[model samples]
Target: MVRIVFVALANLLILVRYLLGLPFRLLASRHRPTHVRFRLAGDPPYRERRRAPLRLRLGGSSLEPATVSSLESFQEALGLLAKDPRVKGILLELEGLEIGSAKKDALVKLLTDFRAAGKRVVAWAVSTDSVGYQVMCAADEVLLAPAGRLELVGYAAEATALGEGLARVGIQAHFVRRGAYKTAPELFTHSHVSDIQRQTLEAFLDERYAELVEAISRGRKRSPEEVRALIDAGPYSAQRAVSAGLVDAMCSEADLPARLEPPRPEEKAKAPAESEAEAEAEESLEPMDTWLAALPWAPVKWRPVRRKPRLGLVVLSGMIVPGKGSGGPVGPTTAGADALVKAVRAAGRDKRAKALVLYINSPGGSALASELILEAVQRVARKKPVIAYVDQVCASGGYMAALGAKEIWTAPHAIIGSIGVFAGKFEASGLLERLGVRRTIIARGENAGIFSVSRGFTPHERESLEAEVEETYQAFLGHVAKARGRTKEEIHERAEGRVYSGTRAMTAGLVDRLGGFEDACRHALNLAKVPTEKFELMTYGGGARRRSLLQLLLSMSSTHLYALCPTCWGLAGFKAGEHFDG
Candidate 1:
């Protein structure tokens, strides 16, 4: 009882601290209306505060999370740039960093947009490596310290195979997937990339890399071939880089900022303490509003302020499972049929919700679960527009769920399709024999031991399971054909368990359009007949923490959700000590 009391008190204190600290933290973290920073070497004069541009420093390793904060900061800085006419230029310093290529792509786009609008983007690097130089290449003024070096290296990808490694330990992996390109489990099944997968991956990398080269060449005013050659022969000194069109000039490290914008004594003024404190407080406020909230100070709100039609976004991420489940970071497995059915029914009953958008980011799993979700989608589509948006890889069961949508929007790079099904069984009779283990079962049916891994299935059992798999495959094809407005023969050619990227999928008639979430939302509003100018996006859940935590708790305790995927892969690296022969 004492221990329990102590624990409760500690929890209470933590809760209080978090509650109180959040507000202040938010305020402190809020973007200042006017950003002020001192140069590395000197202080600014009082009057210069009015002329100073918002000062920001960028850092990160991949756009994932650690870098997401930096991106948010960049957005805030951009907002300041837009509002404050006094804001002159942005100094984008690229230093030693490990940000992901995806994040780099987004940042490049954002910076490009800013530069296009006549904002100065000056990038400086102390010692430029390949990763750092990639970002520098996007800057209007790529500056290198006279003595600094720039290294450009080619791209490479590495994979660790778990198949043979686990085999020696007596563990057996049974994989059941439909698409030839569903390579998620290849980590466990194959030691190296198959020829087909290799070709696809290479093609994708080539396209992205080429885009990078072109963007850099345009930004630096260099020929694409010349820029490519410079990157190819890298590890060049600052002077050499400037001569090769890789940089605008090589200047002393201390003199670059002064050249960008000479520090004026009048630009260094600070705001009053009281006003600064109040501004900070306002910045710390929570982001609680909806669409208008996202754009708080707009001259005119996109939709009406008082009333707007709400859009229901139903996200189905990860592997599909049965029963009920939430989606996202360590959430429930694929939403069970029942959960999807219930959600769709709720959406239909809610008159305020104008339309529904199904956001999917799954590799597909559990055919039965997919069927349940499909049923819900079908029911929802009959009443209102149900649009499907694919992010990342949505294959096999993922495609199954999308079949009921009136239309589908896939990201340009999104991986979609994989209308195939395979049922797998492990035969461990050899391992059992080696261990001197014998099994005897007495049952009325010859296929009674169908689930036993120690023995191969009887012909009757094999035929039954194969028939079921084929039936499921046919159902998948039929649904896709109807949804896509394609005939059976046309879909059959593309639906034989083959995966296609968003671009390829569009050509194959597997997807209606190539777009992102924003496009899907607009399409949904248009289809639902909600005046495009007056609809609201209504997210179903709370903040990510509450939503994700609740989902994890629910998934672990829910007996109905039994997905073989995420479950098997997560445990693959661990020693289950289960011996088998495949």
Candidate 2:
């Protein structure tokens, strides 16, 4: 009896702890604490009542695909700084961050905006890679770490060639893409860079890198010639950096606080709260950032700041899938085909929507789902001016969905078009056979083999699949031709299972214009003749709630119910940032 009581007590305690910790865990998740710290080491309190300086510290690891979450954190920090009245300026430390030139440009752009808001930005670096220095160049004052090394090597890129790797694994890759520029499969087929892939990738990087250099030079008050000379000079010491005017001063991290100025006398020597309730109140009194709060669903905070007329921008991101869910097998959360259709219909039904902009950023999935989304877009287009914006990448079924719009807009670097269909089964029969795992039969017909894992496809099965691909491809071409008012032949010529950049798409009549999401919205507004001051901009993803608690709990209860699609699987990991990492 005593043993049973002890066991019951242990179970009860476990349950209580779990229940009590739930809310705190959620709160902690909502409050993403930055691991990057700033030390106010040895600064003297200000004597002045006003114009007292504040010491800010910036520290973070290299932001990249691996640590991509930091980008969201940085964005939140920017928003906080934008509205913080107490902040006098930003202290940027660029040494620790390992980012590419392109990413640096984006970070620099944010810093420039901060500076433009009447706040000074002082950056210090112990060592600066050629690309990393681009960010430091944007600061009001760039400082050097006394003992830091600065490597000024120019731009270059490296890729992991997979042909040999795959060969060792006994996998033969066949490349069937049409465009020479469509080099996606080359990774598995070629041991070295093809002249085409090398030239294209290099040319593309050169253009973007040059643009960044020019932008940085102007921001740093240096001529392009000076910047170019520095890049060509290569590795330099901190002293050399100071002499070259690349940095304002050389100092150690310990001396940073002494150089900073706080805001006012009251801001310094602030009293600590004595009571826990007071501490709690101080924390709760902090202004919550709506953007940060809405990051889970890619939230947008658009105010009528200037009463700009807003076109209906319906973003159909992610793979096209059936039902009333979001996300599919791969990529970001997407509206279900049915839900998207409803949204499109509602926008058309509302006179206030004025015009519609269908923004697509998907890798394409599910033939039936794509067709349904296409139908929805077509339904909307019939009533009002509809435009399609392809950002980052839109291919295969993505291109199929874009056919619903009257005009298509894409970025110069955007990957658009892949008018094709592909459906293949992964055959594991040979491996299973080698492993002596023979299968016992229990199928109704030969067609059952269509989804079997036991064997490779027969020649007849290949023909049937090819026929299906061809049928889907032709249907895709028909939609493009009809929407763009082009001849069937014209679309057929461009729609041979190929991908093209937005600019090339425009030249080949695949896309009507070369522009970004904003451009697409502007076009829709113009075509609809809706003044920019009329409508309030609204978005879908962030506000749409996930499944109810009961459903989630029930889902957790069933371990065998694995997600068959990637879209549904990635929804739980949905982040609030633009999906444009090339």
Candidate 3:
């Protein structure tokens, strides 16, 4: 009751603040002109610069949040620019842009659409690596600062093995995996990559490298061979990049306006007095976000009186863990079973929501947790259509949850598959002896201490664990076969804990189609038989709510089998033991 009262009071305070600021907001909006006019200062003395091209900073700090609001707002701004006649063109200022391959492809498609609308799209950057350069390539014209460099280095998949280090410290990992390719346990059990691990990493790298070459070839109007050659001889200077046709020109931010809009012949002949007047009339460039927020209706929150069929979006990101996982704007996030089940059920119960889109960005986690979420998703699918959209990494347990969806749509570069299971525990008996620490345990059952960290697993215990892992793996295969409408044998060929790119997954019958979030949204609408022109998008479960420290500790202490992919975690930029260390 106290908590509810506090929440109500907080909301009341927010309402009061908004009401108090309304008058000033209205006044500011009324004073700011919708459009500005510029005089050429010659024969055409008064030229209307009604909609000076808008400037947008593509990456950097704006994309730091791993939230739906950030992505949704960016997409909304682009939609506004595409539809608004005042937005003649857009200048992209790119910096510190780092994103996954799937997201990069989605962004490239948005930029491509902007260009297709017959509006000029120019991108400027100081220095950038492969990710930023790939995004910049989407622009019609790519500009680089005079002293900047393009570090167009190739892709690499690296893994760190701590088996030897653990051995030296008198610690050992006892694990049982269903498939040879299920290599997550190798991080703690083996000193180096296994034969299958090497093959998997090499194949994955080859696919990504090919995709990069194709993207650059299409963007820069170069052949695949030419793009490959350029990539091989990368780290080019600004002038050299232009000479090599990788960049349009060596330019600065100040010179961007001239490139976007050429000066008129009459403007070159302007008198000092006329030039000053024209300069005063010219409107200065504003940040895209600032312009969006300054719009008259931006501050207002309105709801439609009439109800309409809506597409429900539920995001499942980060590692899939048991219980209710914790996260916020800061710190790491996890896909908790308890939280997701509740969200899915809520979406299912919403009368206005005609279809559901499961946006998954997980690399899989706890087997039981994944199963619980999958059951919830399947329950919802029975009532309405469910479309799973793979963002970047969706492997193992993540893919298991995706099976509940009626259809799976993935970005071309998304990682998918890995239908396998593994379970293990670390033994520190040797370490305890080395430290001269004696410990005693009394268990009622033979296998009661099976998961104890004090001792390693016995032969009988190992056999029992292997049987359980095999059973889980078989169940995973069965689920995939049923979802994909394929025989168990057919699905098994593509299973064995192996992951594939989105394109390959489609070919392997693991995914239904290759597309991005917007495409998935359209498909959901189509499946729901809702009119594409008018429909509502109701998103749920995207917020990363904070959890108490005690809850987090309890969640972390629990033991269970995991249907996870360490390689996928590595691709997501996490080291093997980082999550536990925190």
Q: Top TM-score: which candidate number? A: 3
Error of 3 at 79 (Å): 6.4
Query: What stretches of model 1 exceed 4 Å from their correct place?
Result: 1-80, 90-110, 122-138, 141-167, 171-193, 226-261, 265-305, 325-341, 428-438, 541-582
**Model 2 compared with the native: what TM-score?**
0.57
lDDT-sorted candidate list, best first: 3, 1, 2
Per residue, candidate 2 scores C-alpha lDDT tens digits across 358-442 of 7776656566678888898888888899988764556767777888898888766556665655445434455566677888556
The candidate that wins on lDDT is: 3
Query: What's the distance in Å from true for residue 381, model 1?
Result: 1.6
**Candidate 3, poorest ten consecutive residues by summed lDDT:** 39-48
The candidate, 1 or 2, that scores higher on lDDT is: 1
Q: How much is the lDDT of residue 221 in candidate 3? A: 94
Q: After superposition, how far is residue 318 of candidate 1 from its true place, in Å?
A: 1.6
Per-residue lDDT over 454-558 for candidate 1, one digit per residue giving the tens place of the 0 to 100 score: 555567876766667667767777888788888877888886556666788889888899865556777898987777754556544212111263443233221
Better of 2 and 3 by TM-score: 3
The segments of candidate 3 whose C-alpha lies over 4 angstroms from its true place after superposition are 1-88, 273-284, 287-305, 327-332, 542-559, 572-582
**Model 3: per-residue Cα lDDT over 183-224, one tens digit each:** 877877898767777777777678767877888898899999
Give the whole-model CA lDDT for all candidates, comma-separated: 0.58, 0.57, 0.73
Cα-based TM-score, every candidate: 0.65, 0.57, 0.80
* Total backbone collisions, model 1: 16
- Cα RMSD to the true fold for all candidates: 13.0, 15.5, 9.7
The backbone clash count of each candidate, in order, is 16, 18, 0
